[model samples]
Target: MSGSSARFSGSTHLLCCLGAVSSTIVIAMPAGALARQAASPPTLNDPSFDAALPPLDSAAPQPAAPPVPVAPRAPAPDPELIQPLEPIGSADTTPPAPTAEQAGTGDATLRIRYETTVTGLAGFKTDAIEGDLGRQFRALSALIKDGNKAANAAQVKARADEDVQLAQRIMKAAGYYDGIASSTIDLVPGQPGVVRVTLSATPGPRYVLNTITVTGAPPEPTKIARDSLGLKAGQPVDAALIEGSEANVSLQLPQFGYPFAKLGDRDIALDDTVHNADYVLPIDAGAKSRFRNIQTTGDPVFTVSHLNVFPRYKPGDVYDSRLVEDIRQALVATSLFSTVSVEPVKTGVINPDGTEAVDLLVRQTKGPWHSLAATAGYSTGQGATATGSYTWRNLFSPEGALILTAVAGTQEQGGSVTFRRSDAGQRDRTFQTVLAIDNNRYAAYKADTADLSVSLSRTSTPIWQKRWTWSLGAEIVGTNEAGAALTLGGAQPRITYLVGAIPLLLGYDRSDSLLNPTKGFRITAKLSPETSLKGGKVSPYARTLLLATGYYPISPSLVLAARGQVGSIFGTSVDDLAPSRRLYSGGGGSVRGYGYQQLGPKDANNNPIGGRDQTEFAIEARYRFGNYGIVPFIDGGRVGESSTPGLSGMRYGAGIGGRFYTNFGPLRVDVATPIARKPGESVIALYIGIGQAF
Candidate 1:
C-alpha cells in the first residue's frame, strides 16, 4: 500500500465528568471510534516541556520513608467513553491555512475507545489515573487532527507506530509498566475518506513510591523544603508529585537569596517486579544577592506618597521576590492603576556587591470614571422599593470618590451625597462623610430625619489572619417620630432634638467570598452612645448590637447557612429613642416568616412601634445547580420594651427561595408565610433583591 493509504495513529486522553464529584475530564472521539495507531505511543512526558535533560542515574534500593495515609474517596460515575467529536488541541497551527476543500475534510476519519480499568488502587489514586489517561489521549488525538496528519497509506501506518509509543509512555506514567495499549483500524465499506478505529488499554499493576533522595542542597538551609515534600513511600507513584517537588527544590534556593538558582537533575528509577518507584533530585543554589533601588514605570499619578507606603524592603536588603509581589498588590489595590508589574530589572548586571535592582511598573487609570447602581427590593412588611446611585471615581486622587444615592420605598425615601477617601496604604483604611434627609416609615412610627456623619474604618488581613475590621465615627441626628404622637411618658411626641453620637464597630470575616459563602463565619458588633443636646431633652443613651453569620458546605454544590442577631438600648425609654434608633425585626434581614418589624409588641394603633430590644435567628439549607441555587429557610425573631432583649413571644417564618448567581452578586427572590400570623398581618409575602438575604 502507498504511504497515503496506510492507517495513521495518535494518542489522546481527557477526563469526562462522571455524574459529578471528581474534577471531570472530557474526551473527544470520532463518530466511529478509535482507529489504528502509528507506533508504540511516544514517551508520556513530551521532551520540550520536561525538565532540562540528561536523565539522572539509577541506584540500588534505599530505605523508604513512612507513608502518609490518604482517606478513601467515592468513585466517580463512569465517563462517557464515546461522544461526538469536537475540535481539539486548538486548530492546528502547523500547515498553511487549509483551503475550503481540505478544511471540510480531515485526515482519514478515526475514533478512540478507552477500555482501561484497574483496581487495588483506591480513592483519589484510582480516579487520578483515569483523569490522566483521558487527558493524554485527548492531546495525542489533537495532534492527529492537524491538517498535516499523514496523507499517504504508508505514512498513516507510521503514524500508528508512533501511537503505540505514546500509549506506552502514558501507561508508565500511570505506574503501569506492564500495561499494554492496542488499536485496530478498518476502512468503512460505504464511506469514502472515513475509517473506523478502536483503541483499548490494559492498565496493569500500580506502583508505589520506594524512596526519595535529594542532592546538591545545602544541608542546614534545605532541611525545611526537604522535610515538607508531600510524597511518601507506599503512595502511588505519581509523576506530577515528583515534578512538583523538583520544581519546589528549584524555588527554595531563589527564595533564600540565590539569584540564579537551578534544578540540576531529576531521576526516577522504576522497578517492575517490586512495583516501586524511587525519585532523586539535584539542586544548584546560585550566588546570594542583595536588592538595590526600585525603578518604577514612572506614572506620575501614582504619587510618591501612594507608592512609598508599600515598600517592604529597601535598598541593600536581601533580595526577596515576595516583596516585589507585595508592591504589585499594593499598587493594584489602590485602584489607581489599570496594570502593575513588579519584578527584578538588573540581576544580569549585578552591582559590585552582587545586588540586583528591581522595578515596579504601573499604568495609571484615566478620566473621571463613573458607575451607576440600581436596586429593587421587596418584603412582606415594606412591600417594595427601588434605589439608584451614581459614583464618580478618582475625584481628587486615585483613592478618592463621591457618590450620589436616592432611595424610595414603602418604608423609606431619601437621597444623600457621600464623599470617600482611602489612601491609608495596604490596610485599606477609609474615611467617608454623608449628608442626607429621609422619611423613614417604621412599623412602630413614621420619622422625618436630617443627618450628617463621618466615619473612618480599616480592614486588615495578615498571617494568623484575624480578618477583622475596625471603625469609629460620629454623627449628628435630629428627627421627629411616632406621627408626632405622645411619648412613653404620654407627653408630646419626642422630636426636634439634636443628638450627638459616636459609634464603634468591630467585624471579623473569614468567608471565602463576601456575596455568597460556602464556608466560614463572620461576626460584627457595634456600640453607639449618644447625648441629646437640645433643650428639654436629656435622653442620653447607649445602643449595642451583635450579629454573626455562618456557612457550612455539605457538598461542592450544597451549603447550610445561618445567621443570628441581638440588640438592645439602654438609658432611654422606647418612646425617647428615635424611631430609626429603636430595635425591630421581621424583615428579609431578620425573621423572614413575618412582616417587617411585625414579630414584636405593637402600639395602641396596632402599628409597629420600635422596641428597645430585638433578637433574630435564621437558618437556610442551600443547594446549587451550576450557577443557580434553591434554598429553604426558617426564621425566628423577638422584640421587647425592656432594655434587656427578651426572647418571649418570638415569631417564626419559613420559606423557599431561588438564587441566580452573577458576577456582581446573586439575584434572589423568595416567598414566605408567617408560621404564626397575627390577625391583622398579611398571610403571605414576597421579597426580591440582590445578594443573599442577609
Candidate 2:
C-alpha cells in the first residue's frame, strides 16, 4: 500500500508539471499567434486522456473515487484575452507594425535638418529680396519643401539664367553691346538647395572732342562759322553731329553765292579719362569771283542799246545770279517782252588767287499782242451788265502800252483810256496815266452821278530780298450828279468839285504766285493827304486804307486764307466829294453773299448811302484740283458814318466760289446768296473777277 501511495504522489507531481507547461504555452504562444492571425488558433494537437489513464492512481483512489466523475474544471481563461482561434496559414504572415516613437521622431528630424540646411546658406539674405525678389523667394522655398528637388534645381538654374539674360537685355536697351560688362553671371555657393547670384557690368569706352574747327567756305563766313559749328570744347564726339555740322556748313555757303564750297575732311580724337572728344574740320573755300562778260541772243525785237535799259549789273560788279534775276524781272515788267532769261556761263578755270570769272547771257522774246474780250453778268445792286475791252500791248514802242474799255447796262456806263510804261528808267519805276469818266446809277436808290478823273502814278520796286512795292501819285477829279431827294418835291442839287491830291502807297507781298498764294502774307497801306499846291481848292481831303491778308497751306491741294481791310475818309465835305471817294462795303470782295455796295447804311429808296468809313473781314478755305480750285468762304463787314455808326451796324455773308487758272491769272466766279438783308433786298447775286481780292 505504501508503494502504491508513492506512485500516486509521483503521478500527482507529473500532473502539476504538465499543468504548468500548458499554462506557459497558452500565455506566451497566444500573443504571438494573435499577431500572426486575427483569431485564436485551434486547440493544441496532444494525446487524448481516457479513463484508463488513471490506472496508476486506481489502487490509491479506488476507495475514495467519487460516485460521479469530477467534471473537468473549465480551462483557465486564456492569458491572451483576444487570440486567433483559427488554424495558422501562409496567408496570415505579416510584418511587425512600427511603434509611434519611430515614425514621429524620424520624420520630424528629417524636416528639421532640411530646413536648417536651407536657412544656413551664406549668400541667402532674406532682406535682399525686397519687391519681386521676395515673391520669388517664397515661391522657391515652397517648392523645396514640397519634395520637388528636381523642379527646384531647374527653377534655380532657370532664374539664374534669366538674371543674366535680363542684365544683357538692360545693356542692350542702353545701346551697349559687345562689351566686357555683358559677359556672364557668377553664382556663389551656399548650403544645399540655396545659391546666390551676382552680375557685374563693364562699361564701354567714352569718346571726347579733341579739336573743333570750321570745315567749309560758307557764303557768309562769319555767319556760317557762328551758326554751323556744332562742337564745343569738352563735348562728346558724335558721328551724327560731325556729319550734321559738315552738311550745315556746306549749305550755308550757297546763300552767300558760294555754290562750290565744301567740307573736305574731318578728324576726331577720343580721351578716355574724362570721357570727352575733340574734332578737327577742314574747310575748302573755293573760287570767289565776278561776272566777266554779258551776251544776249534770241528773237530780239529790241536793239542791244534798248535791252541795256534793263541792265542787271555793270562791269566789274560782284557776280550775283540774284542781280541777274532782277534784270530778268525788269525785262518782264516792261510788258513789251513775253519771255526773258538770264543765266551765268561758268568758266572752268579758277584764277590763281582762288577767284572765278563768270559770263552773263541774256535771252528775250519779242511780242506784239492784240486781245479782244467780252463779258456779261448780272448783279442785284448794278443789274445786268455787259463789257467789251480791246488791248494793244507793246504798241508803238517796247515800253508803250494802251487799253480801251467800254461798259453799258445797269451797274455803270463808262469809258476809259489808259496808257502804261514799265521799267521807264526813271529810278527803276513804272509809270501809268489814266483818264476815266463814268455815269453810275444805283438800284437801291434813285441816285445818278457822273465822274471824270485823270491820274498819274509811279511804282517802284527796290532790291532788298523782300517783295515790296511803293507808289506816289497825283490826281485831278470832277463830278456831276442828279438824284431824287428823300421828299417828293425836293430835287437833289447837281454838285461838282475839282480836287488834286498826292497819294503814297506802300505794299509788301510774299507768295508763291500772284494767282494762287499757298503760303505767305500780303499787306497794303495807302495814305492820300491832299496838298495845298494843286489845281483848285485842295479840298482838305484825306483817305487812309489798310489791307492785310494771309495764306496757310493745309496740304498740297488745300489752303486756308484770311483777309482784313479798313478804309476811312476824313477832312471832306460829304456833298462836295467825288463819288469814287466814298466808302462802300458788301459785295463779292467784301461780304460775299451781299449785293455790291448793298450791305451798308441805306436811304429810304434802298440806295447804298455812301459812308465815310468801312471795314471788312474774310475767311476762306480752298481745295485745289490740278490748277483750278474751289472755295467756300465767309465774310463780315460794315459801312457807316465814321462818327455815328457803332459795332452793331455790321452785316455778314457766306458763299461758295470757283477759281479757274489761266496764264494771266486765276479767274474767279462766285454765286452768293444774302444771309441777312432788309425786307425788299434780293437774296442772291453773282460776281466775276480776276485774281485774289486782297
Highest TM-score scorer: 1
Error of 1 at 643 (Å): 0.4
Q: What is the lDDT of residue 419 in candidate 1?
A: 93
TM-score against native, each model? 0.70, 0.53
The candidate 1 region of ten consecutive residues with least summed lDDT is: 1-10
What candidate 2 gets wrong by more than 4 Å, as runs, is: 1-289, 292-300, 303-314, 329-359, 363-365, 369-378, 384-387, 396-398, 426-428, 444-466, 488-492, 530-539, 625-630, 643-646, 660-665
Writing each residue's lDDT as its tens digit, candidate 2 over 1-694 gives 1111111111011111111112244444445444554787777555565533656644563366568767888888876876766665646677555457537655422321122121212221122233322233334543344442323345544544444444333332222222222122223356543334343443244244555665444545645654766666654343344556667766665445554555655554333444444455666656666656667798865556666676656755556556776777766655555777877666765655566776667887775467788877654565677889888877756566688989898658888887876556542556777777777776333323333333344433332223777787777655555432565444554445455677888888886666667899889999987522223544576888899999999998888999988888887654445545677887766777777777676655556667778788899888889778898888888887772334567777777888887776678887777665668666776777776654
Q: Estimate the TM-score for candidate 2.
A: 0.53
Q: Tell me the tens digit of each residue's lDDT in model 1 across 1-694.
A: 1121111111221211213223567998769777887787666767675665545575456799889999999887556745556688776668576666565666333322222222222222332335556465546652254433345545454555556556656665555656666555566676665454455566677777778676776774356346646667887765555566556655565566655666655666666657776666566655567775555554565565566666877767776667767677766655555566666554455667655543444444443357788988887778789999998867767577888999998789999999987755454678889999998776566778889999998765322133788899999988875532344434235456677899999999888777777899999999999887445868899999999999999999999999989998888786666666778787777777677777666655566776888888999998999889999999888888897876788788889999999887789988888886768877777888887976
Tell me the whole-model lDDT of each prediction, alpha carbons only.
0.69, 0.59
